[model samples]
Target chain A: DQQVKQNSPSLSVQEGRISILNCDYTNSMFDYFLWYKKYPAEGPTFLISISSIKDKNEDGRFTVFLNKSAKHLSLHIVPSQPGDSAVYFCAASKGSNYQLIWGAGTKLIIKP
Target chain B: EPEVTQTPSHQVTQMGQEVILRCVPISNHLYFYWYRQILGQKVEFLVSFYNNEISEKSEIFDDQFSVERPDGSNFTLKIRSTKLEDSAMYFCASSEDRGQGHQPQHFGDGTRLSIL
Candidate 1:
């Protein structure tokens, strides 16, 4: 079974526009969530994240909002730039040190 | 500025051959992990190690796979007998702290293993 899912395989947005990527999870045991951006042939780079106790967390151009009741979360990028083009993965873990349950990932294309 | 480092950016091995992938995690990190992503698929967890022992492993990690921290700084994954299905990008990750649901794991560029 897919514990975490990113139904949308890909997303595209214009430069300077707001882009949103969504993810969902079935495991209620998950207590922490994270987003990672990956470029081809490179390891994934850590993005923003939110604790289960908090609904939202923001850093610079990235903001992650979690709706625990809905078992869903979204990452929002303000004024998205071409450099933001990459595959974004959503992962969840139940404990602070538990294994990560990853989503299939969403490829974001920021059109210049 | 510490980052996980994986050797042999790409490897191609024949079926039934044994292969070992190596990684050097951050100096101060106490936790290490191995994850793999098949072509066009989500990354999946294989195992996590801490204090020179395995802390957790997933269903995908079977008898054919083994992990070892032979030295103070090197972590290695060995596949006793490789199979075609083992082709994928293997990533190494590490975390300074051990908080299951909270801390971020830094990853290496990954070694793309191509089993023939």
Candidate 2:
């Protein structure tokens, strides 16, 4: 029973274009959502997140949109850079204590 | 920015041997968790701890596995008798609290354990 899922295994986009990654959840009790970017041989680094109350959250070039009714969320990176190429994992936490349901991760490749 | 830290970036242990993985979560964070990922697999939650007690744990956390916050700053995961299937990258993450959008968890570099 995977509560969180990223259906796309990988995505490719040109530099300076937009890269959108999607995620869905089955557990309605999840109140908070998070994104993490990981590179080879390193731990996942925290990215942006949004609460179920909000529709969107943005930080610099990255943005996250959450639709509670749809039980879905997506991450958008504008003007995608080569540096953004990595495995992006979408995570959701129910109440607290940092327990997260993680997706397998979507690998993004930026074409120059 | 305070971040989680793990020691002995890599460990190779023989089957049936006891192994302890250490971690130091962010100072102000109130929650700590341990997760593991097999090569090319999704990260799986193991256990979460708060107030010196386990808040939640997955089926993966069997009787052979135990967690302890021995002192002020250290969180450890111990495998009493590790098996070959125990080989994986163990990650430690910390969050300030739950339900807050800023509750972004910071993760350690992870301890990669190889069981032989």
Candidate 3:
């Protein structure tokens, strides 16, 4: 099912620049959205999250923006570091059920 | 920091053999879930367990697949009979109460199962 989708398979950015990742969902019932970062052989690490009630949520250098009208969401990491290079996944869930619908993930490559 | 633990990082079994994947979620976490990701694909949810019973399951979780919390600490997923398509990386995750919004689930370094 293509409920969630990450159109970009890969992204490249400078180490000290801003990195933006985009995601789209077809299901409007999704209320909670989360971003995860994963290394080559490790499980996904929770990064940031935002609820449908709010349009933006920021933590440190990570910010998640949600556009309910467009059924789209984006993640922005300021001053990207080399360690930030990994596959980023955007997930969405409905209410309290917590069954996460995941995207194909975008591989971020930070260049120094 | 507490983290989820999974056993047998890599498992190779015959197509008709039965396989059991084990996971130990973080302490104090009540909600548990199982998900699998095939090569070059998105992660797909299999099942979610809470309060000693299944709360939700996806279509991918067929009759051949089952989950159990045999003891107080460990949760397991068993495949009755494996098929070639059963090869994938299985991940276990846990979280606290679901009533609260934005409770991010903690995931374990998944177990990779390869059906021969």
Candidate 4:
């Protein structure tokens, strides 16, 4: 069962533009959410995360917005760079739980 | 910045044979995990380890799969009688104490296991 779903299999955006990736979850018990970026042949790299108590968290050019009532979250990368072209995965876990339920991932392509 | 490291970038083993994948997490991290991703499939969690014991595990971690911290710097996943379906890219990850807050997990490059 897919508890976390990234409906977009792939997305292409122009460099210097904003790229938005969306994620939906069926489990409301998940209290913490995170976004990870992965490149070919490399393991996933942690990008950012948000707690259920918060609606949004931002770091540099990346911002993650969580809508707890809708069980949905989105990651926004402003002024997307070529380096941002990678697979983005959304993961969530409940209170103090070590296990992270992950999405299938969205392949983001930044075109110059 | 310290990062998790895994050994044997690629491994090829015959079906039914035992295989072991090794990892060394960041020195200061306290939590460790094992995950695998099959070709064109989502990454699946296998097990989580802390305080020298299993903290959590998924159904994919069946009787044939095992994890160990053989040394202060090493964590290993041993598959006793592997099946062809077990062939996948196995990743090792580590995170700081959760008591502070939700610490992001850092992953290793992963070892690609190919069961022949």
DockQ-sorted candidate list, best first: 3, 1, 4, 2
lDDT per residue as tens, model 4, A1-112: 6899999999999999999999999998899999999999999999999999999999999999999889999999999999999999999988543788889999999999
- Candidate 1 regions off by >4 Å? B99-101
Model 4 steric clash pairs: none
| Cα-based TM-score, every candidate | 0.97, 0.96, 0.98, 0.98
DockQ preference between candidates 3 and 4, better one: 3
Clash pairs detected, candidate 2:
none
The C-alpha stretches of model 4 lying farther than 4 A from their native spots are none
Score residue B65 of candidate 2 by CA lDDT. 98
Model 2 chain B: which ten-residue window has the lowest total lDDT? B96-105
Give per-residue CA lDDT, model 2, range A1-112, as digits (tens): 5889999999999999999999999999998899999998899999998888899999999999999999999999998999999999999988555578999899999999
In order, the Cα lDDT scores of the candidates are 0.93, 0.92, 0.94, 0.95
DockQ of each: 0.74, 0.65, 0.74, 0.73
lDDT score for candidate 2 against the true structure: 0.92
Per-residue lDDT of candidate 1, residues A1-112 (tens digit): 5999999999999999999999999999999899999998899999987889999999999999999999999999998999999999999998766688999999999998
Ranking by lDDT: 4, 3, 1, 2
> Which parts of model 3 are misplaced by more than 4 Å?
none
i-RMS for every candidate: 1.6, 1.8, 1.3, 1.3
